[model samples]
Target chain A: MKAIALKLCSVTGMKWGIPFVKLFSGEEVLEQLKEIWGTVGIPLIAIVTFLLIWHFGAKQIDTSLGQVPGPAMVWEQTKALWAEHVDERIKADEFYARQDARNAAKLAKNPNANIRVVDYTGKPTYIDQIFTSLKTVFMGFLIASLIALPIGIICGLSKKIMQALNPMIQVFKPVSPLAWLPIVTMIVSAVYVTNDGWLEKSFIISAITVSLCSLWATLINTALGVSSVNEDYINVAKVLQLSPTKKTFKIVLPATLPLIFTGLRISLGVGWMVLIAAEMLAQNPGLGKFVWDEFQNGSSQSLARIMVAVFTVGIIGFILDRIMVELQKLVSFDKKTIA
Target chain B: MALLELHNVSKGFGEGKYRTEVLKNINLSMEEGEFLAIVGFTGSGKTTLIKMISGLLSPDEGEILFRGNPVTGTSHERGVVFQNYSLLPWFTVYENVALAVNERYPDWTKETKDIHTRKYIEMVNLTPALNKRPAELSGGMRQRVSVARALAMNPEMLLMDEPLSALDALTRGTLQQEIINIWTKDKRTALLITNDVDEGILMADRIIPLTTGPNATLGPEFRIDIERPRDKTELNDNEEYKKTRNDIIEYLMDMGAEVKTKKTTNYRLPELKPIMPGKTFRKRKEEDKLKYF
Candidate 1:
């Protein structure tokens, strides 16, 4: 039973369930009971208490858009958003079916004619905006990692390189995504000109802004990781006469991986945050844009809808962090320190 | 020709006024298949000497030659067993040994490599902990793994830098026996740098003392004429063992005192006017009394 619990904890993100399993198995009942309470019961109770406060406190607050949304109002808006997504998906399916049918008829009439089916260019729902935000953040994070890791390694390996790059890193590290947004928008607009391209100009601008803002964390962390490699390991490599490339991959990379992953996690988080702000300011299609659009809408339902987006963003951010934690656990050799 | 030779090797750290000479005019050599031990105090340049032989460090004054060739940089020809074990924390014992074996014998078959890796691991008696990472192992066990890794490389020479110092007495004794047994079976040209006088006598064909630094150098060599399979229990009764141990200890003690005297006497106040020694002493005493009054 313990074995099963351990396996379950590792294979899935159900480590919180281990205490319950132990309690059921009658192993140190009092301690396990406390663990269960701490892991599960306490969080549930706190969430319930928060909802109660929000439900009551929402009644006293009033804005130009009417009362602030209570728990029920936000839930209603969440349901409405989900329902709108489902309705849009159904309309998209019909549009595709109609296009396919028309394309078939055209091909039947004249085999040589162009029968291209147009995409369903409908209004994106809340779910679509969430997906767009995720895609943009990941793209930016990937780009940031690719550029930062090599430069970081080189900087770590050589003091001369680090000295040369130090000024640039210091100058650019603290710049806000908002500051980058204008320059990125201008560059992307000037460079990415096409009526129907693989990616939109707004997306390229937002992604570039996210990369500019987020790359510093990864760069700094990776350099630190590389610099902090063990002297003994370096000696081992020297004695073994390991080629430079092999030394980096075999000894240096493994030694510094924990710090590198730490940098990546922070970079991913920074990228996610920067992406949202960029989307909102650029009026791009994402959760941030959805919130901005609702804020400008100025209806009674707008506040509730925006509240729904707020919860969505918080939950998604938490999930993204958890994913990075899991990745870190997989890569890190020092397991005792991770938790 | 000697397996390794160092000719008037000197090394120092820092530059100009801040410079501190750690090793000075140190000349030493080891014969092929001969075990040599260097005993010294902490900060006595023993580690620096070992690094020089291993080609991890370059001498400022002279060159080190291995098999008549001038040693340039670190090479697979010399395998080192470091004091701290230096195992990758992520790798298991088998993997750690295998990493070196793979590097040293890259063209060997997989089966041959695995067998070779296992043979040395078995030599160190770490088969039970073969799957365990360094973090999981005790200090003694980690050292054993390092020993196994160095041996598995099949290098022409083995260099150990205080490898048993971190272990407790019991583990250290056991590892010493294991090292002797391994050396007896295959006589690799080996050099051990240790601070322990007893360990040096027990392990090496000859034990050399290193003077304390600000410019440290080898003092004298004491050849251990003890027979093979030297028993720890009977070592107390052996006259030669006692004599070697006492001679090394006495030399180290005298070296310590000599360094202290040298430090005080070597300070030359050349700018001050020379005076009669007794007169100056009286004058300083009178000056002290006047200041107090």
Candidate 2:
């Protein structure tokens, strides 16, 4: 049972829990305590030290708006943001209830009274913006993967294809999201003619920009991974006389999965970074836009709110990376490649 | 027609000043159900030769034939067990074997394939580790899995490239016996490559030596006329086994010496005397005299 729990901890990137589990099992108590201190206690102390530093440091800095908001002010802003979201949700519910009552009254007064229920069009809350950012980033990441993985595999398989595409890949890899945003915005505006389409134009622009900037890491890493599959494994495939497709899926892909997941982790991180920049630059409705708007608002509380968004973005990025690590661990056979 | 044939086959690598002829004029033939072993020193193009027969590699100058047809590419008809085990690390023992079985008998039902895979795994006595991945297995067990995978394909011919060399002595002996037992059951055409003369003589009906490289080729073939089920202990007493083993060893040693002589280069030596650290030679002699007194 302890072994299973330890394995679970490693697989889920919850390695901090391992020492606790081991401590509970009462084996090598001193060692477990040391491990617990290293994994959990040290990190806790470090966080406390950082917060104390930030709290003291804020008093020394004087910006044009005011002194930089400390941890306390950021916490207040976070709570304020959550409270505003809750208040907006309550208002929306009341609006819906009032409309439903009015519709029922209209129907009772006259059997065929023309009654229409309009959709709520309230400004998005901070939580709503966070979801929007997540959705946008995921969509962008999916698009990048869909484009990168097949091309990467083909490039890995055939030298001629790689040679043909290498120059373009090199040229485009270093191009920033900032550079792609305007081009993507123009193209999206010209191509996306429908105003009432399922997707919003701003959303599409941000997603496309993210895809453009994020695909390179996945492409390069996957190609490298595929090309570097062990020669012995390839020989085994040949001995079996597997079909081209079967050989690729069975031997090449499985062998290169660790590297591919590494590429994906990098790609998702790039996509998330690119997504925020794109959303901010494009004035799209997401956390990036929220941050930018708060900066422009320049109110005393706006700086603290923007700091809250910064922390949110950083934490979300960390969680995304951790998720990819877990997925990589689950798929990869080689344990040494986990980190 | 021979089960397999190689005619005037030569293979090399690189080009221009860096070119090397790794194998040259390698000619061999095997009839149906023949157990042939090619013994050679390390880096003598043994693996290169086996790969050619398995169709993973093509000879630069000559063609390889199987059953009177020109060999083109790898096929399930010739299954190879590589030197490094080469079991896919991601796959369990069962999956590693099942992969080949599935590819060979694609039309078979899933259940049938599973049974066939399990049978081969059990043949290698790996039923306990059926679900264990290659990374989890020991070197010997991994090689067993490799052997099982090759055998599960039901190939007409089996090619093994130093499959047991990575294993410990005890494991190597057990796997060697298991392999022989499997080979003798159907007597499928088998080719085993190794540097060990005893391994060749014990398992092969015919043993051939591969000379040291830079144009390594097959030397004279020795026929192992001993009866089947040749026990390792009894082989020590068998006159024929001793004669064949000595002859092969003598021939190999002579070739090794010849190569050493051909490649040897003399270098001038510097005259230097050994001295104890932190003391002159006279001081050391004085200390030795005092210690004796």
Candidate 3:
């Protein structure tokens, strides 16, 4: 049962739970304690120390809004944000219920009347903004991956193609999301003229900008990875008389997948970061927009709320990175320890 | 008819002043079911010869024929066991073997492929390590998997590039015996490239010396007329084994001396030293018929 528990923890990526499982199972008590202290206790202590420092620092510092938000203020703002989210959800539910009743009455009054249930277009809550940001970043990341992987493979396979792409990659790689924003905005506004489309114009602009900025990392890394695939494996593929497509998919792709995942992880992180900046600058509906709005409002609570948003952005980024790493581990057959 | 033949093959790398010729006017032919070993110095283009026959490389000049057809590109007909084991590190021993078996016998049922893969894995005595990846296996075991992978392809011919050179002595000896046992069971045309003279004698029917490079060519052939299933310990005292070993070593040493003398003379005639073809340990007789400058 203890062995099963340990296995379950490992599979779930809850490796920190192993110590507790072992301790409960009457394994070496001291060893389990050491493992727990190294993995969990150390991190908890560090967090507490950081919070103490922030509390002390908050008293000394003064901002234009008021004081720098301490741990307590940030915690309070976090609770307030959660309450706002709940209140918004309740209001949406009530609005939908009222709409349904009104629609039924309209239908009863006139049998052939158009009785449409309109959507609740309330101001998005903090939770809703978080989801918006996640969606935008994912859309951008997906587009980047779709475009970059094939191009990278082509560049890797042919030296001439790589040479042709070299100058373009060099020129575009360092261009910031801020630099891409104006061009992306102009093109999206000019081309995407449809109102009430599946995606908002602002969302499309931000996503395209994110994709443009983030694709370089994946493209370069993927090219490097594909080129570095073992020559012996290629020779084996040749010896087997595998077709071109089979060789690429079966031998080349699998061999370079670990590095490709590394590239993807970087691209996702870059996309997320670029999305936040794009949202702030473009006034798109996301956490970045929320932060900007609160700052412009300049209330006492505004500083604490912005602090909450800051912590939220950090935690979400950490989670996104962890997800990519987990996915990489699942796909890579070479199970070497990764940092 | 020869199963594989190389005719006046010449290969070089680099350009102009940096150009180094690795093989020149290399002529060789092998029949079906014959085990031929080419022993050479470290950089003597033995691998180039093997690659030429395997069709991974094409000679800059001359033609390589496989059963009278010109060899153009790599084919499953010639299976290669590279000096480095070349097993995909991600794949298990069983998967590595099964990959080749499936490729070669695509029409075979999954069950048949599995059984075929297992047969060769068992032949290499790696049944216990079937599920283990290459990284988990020792050097010898990894090489065994490579050997198994190649054999599972069921190719018409086998090309081994010093396959046991990376192994320790005991493992090398054990694998050598395993190879001989497999060869005896299925008499496939085989070419082995090695620097180890004893290995060549122990495993091959005829051992040919590959001269030191900047244009290496095959020297005189030494036929090993020793009986089948020859024991190494017993052969240590055998007069025939000792004499043949000494003769081959003497020729290689002479070639080494020739290389030292070659540095002073920028352009010189290549020696046409020839020895008796079969079952003789006599010294090489300088044949005047062949000449190259």
Candidate 4:
């Protein structure tokens, strides 16, 4: 690094000493020369800039109601928080044992008074929220795929079906999943035939609402993509007298893959986005609930911790998209990998 | 009985708002192992006629029979080689051939399928590039792959819709010879749609000059009785071959004259350009002149 700086200094001195001669000489020589700084310079500059902002810009947030802690403070708290977490784990065991002893003691007095009387945190654990959110998103995505793929294929195959469905699809597509949350919550509350508790049914309703809102883009685009396949190939399939099943699998599906993949990527992104918002509105036991609860509590590190969750979400979503893209490249037949 | 017969087959496009007859009372028949070339104007329904025989489409006004069976939809018995690139873009030369091979011979094991598909690939002299996709292949190589694909199907009848017309002369000549070689060995019922007179003479047993559409029909059937395994380069030197060549040229010339006389008096234009023979466009101008009859 010192050698590089010295070299640059010498070059600059040379450039200053004889402007015309040095300028032309160095310009002509180094113009075509590959420089290490030239290759890695931009990214290095960007990383430095990002670090500076992350270190300094976070301090400027004028949050009045809740104190948004600095990165260093958060790091310190995070470590202390982990120790507290261990302590909490032991406390939880103690609490459960205490409940058992209390129940045993109370059986002699009155059995009803021993009915699980204990202090409730009324706040979600980090691990439970993460697991809950993941399960809900996975279930909602699966449900959406099952319903959308067939309808998409049908609309793709037949023009009349597309024409008939287009109006309804268009109408429902733009309405936000958040908009559907309240209606779904109400409907389920009214007609959940299971004698189960009211609270249990809301999660199912929220998932269905998220699915209906986020899944349309994939289905509509997939159908449109399948329809956009070259007419000649369809005729070729016809010329082969290929069975309907064969035509769908061999001809239609392969032709529509690039488009279908585009839809899938977009749907997954939308589904994840909708899921967070839905959980917030419904007070569901998920990551969204954790963020909302922290916000309401007005903790100093609440915003910083939420920032961590947000960044983590963004990183995870990016990785998921990249995985889909990699899978697409692998399955695609048109591209040749000499291997 | 004719191996394939088209009886008073007439076809038209659109109706009521706009109706135009493309073929009128088209009558033709071909025996088994007899090579027939149907030549015509571009939109003269030559392809449509062959399609009916191959069962790509049905004639609305008449009956087309393949050995007395009514033609309907696509039948595997009649295999077709289309002019434009019809080889699946995604499949390799080997895979393209294997598609039909595996379908036709499903009882064969994977090893057997590989062997048989390879045999046809070698037959077309495309073995080195068998693993290459259609996009990777040259025009001639792709056409050879198409030929291999059609042959692999092992159909009773072969229909070619100007299969070699897209190629340059050198590539065209090579594929024509390969096709003739394949034809002589199998002697399947073959129908070729072409406007190249020399190509017709070289390959088909009978050349049926298709008068150009909007109402194109067979003008005449010229017999090509040159010996089996006809060498393309040598045929250009034979006496009988020359006679047949001149006869076709004369017919096409008269057809062009007829086309010239129908609308305008510009029948005697100065030698603006040297007329290229055996090209489909020059031949199509002949049928386009059938304005009156």
* Among all candidates shown, the one with the greatest lDDT: 2
| Candidate 2: residue A24 lDDT (0-100) | 94
- Model 4's CAPRI class is acceptable
- For candidate 1, write residues A42-116 as lDDT tens digits: 999999999999999999999999999899999999999999999999999999999999999998999998978
Q: Which candidate, 1 or 2, has the higher TM-score? A: 2
Q: List runs of model 2 lying over 4 Å from the truth.
A: A1-14, A108-111, B107-115, B266-293
True contacts kept of each: 0.90, 1.00, 0.74, 0.35
**What are the runs in model 4 whose C-alpha is more than 4 Å off?**
A1-63, A66-135, A186-206, A336-339, B15-20, B40-45, B90-95, B105-119, B126-136, B253-293
Give the winner by DockQ: 1 or 3: 1
Cα deviation of A181, candidate 2, in Å: 0.9
Tens-digit lDDT track of model 2 for A210-238: 99888999999899998889998898888
- Ranking of all predicted structures according to TM-score, beginning with the best and ending with the worst: 2, 1, 3, 4
Name the top TM-score candidate.
2
TM-score for the B chain of model 1: 0.89
Model 3, residue A184: C-alpha shift (Å): 1.3
Q: lDDT for every model?
A: 0.88, 0.91, 0.88, 0.76
Worst 10 residues of 3 chain A by lDDT: A330-339
Q: For model 2, what is the error of residue A34's alpha carbon versus the real structure, in angstroms, after optimal superposition?
A: 2.3
